[model samples]
Target: MTKKIEVLGSGCARCKQTTKVMEMAVKELGIDAVVEKVEDINEIVNRGVMATPAVAINGKIVFSGKIPSLEEAKALLSKS
Candidate 1:
């Protein structure tokens, strides 16, 4: 099954880095998943995330406020 992964941020450096990390994790895991960037403030707030550079798997927030390591991203994706 393909997982819906979202990286939430306002296109800042950290956000981009998080997105990159997620991409690398996905590639390394060889898992079917789609990683999207959520840059809209309202959307991010609506999702109940006050911090930028957050991650959500299948509409559920998994990580927030900081960029996760490759292994962390892989673990998060694996759960979904």
Candidate 2:
């Protein structure tokens, strides 16, 4: 199965970095995932995340407001 991983932000540097970290973490863990970058402001707000550079896995909010650690990301990805 493929996990849906999304990085939500306004196309900022932090958002890009978050996506990069997520990609690297997934690659390191050998997990199958479909990653996407969401730059839509409305869509981001719908997630109830009051911060930039958030992450979502399987349509569920996993990390928000800051960059997440690889271990934390792995945990969220595993749930997918």
Candidate 3:
């Protein structure tokens, strides 16, 4: 199954960094996944994320409030 991964933030540096990490992890793992950036405040709040730079895998929030390391992202992707 293809994983639906979302990076939520306001297009800031942290958010971009998270997106990059997620993309690299997906590429390295050779996983079928769609990574998207959620910049809309309403959407982010509706998703129940109180912090920016959050990560959601398959519609479930996995990480939030900080940028994750490459290995951390890889592990998250692997689980998905």
Query: What would the per-residue lDDT of candidate 2 be over residues 1-80, giving only the tens digit for each residue?
Result: 88889999999988988998899889988988888999999999888879989998889887899887778778777766
| Residues 8-75 of candidate 3: C-alpha lDDT, one tens digit per residue | 99999999999999999999999999999999999999999998899999999999999999999999
Badly placed stretches (over 4 Å) of model 3 are none
Q: Candidate 2 versus the native: TM-score?
A: 0.90
lDDT tens string, model 1, 15-80?
999999999999999989899999999999999998889999999999999999999998988877
Q: In candidate 3, which residue pairs get closer than 3 Å at backbone N, Cα or C atoms, i.e. clash? A: none
lDDT of each: 0.94, 0.88, 0.95
Ten consecutive residues with minimal summed lDDT in candidate 3?
Answer: 71-80
Q: For each candidate in turn, give its C-alpha RMSD to the true structure in angstroms.
A: 0.7, 1.2, 0.7
Q: Order the candidates by TM-score, highest first.
A: 1, 3, 2
**What is candidate 2's CA lDDT for residue 75?**
76
lDDT of 3 at 48: 94
Clashes of 2: 0
Off by over 4 Å in 1: none
Greater-lDDT candidate between 1 and 2: 1
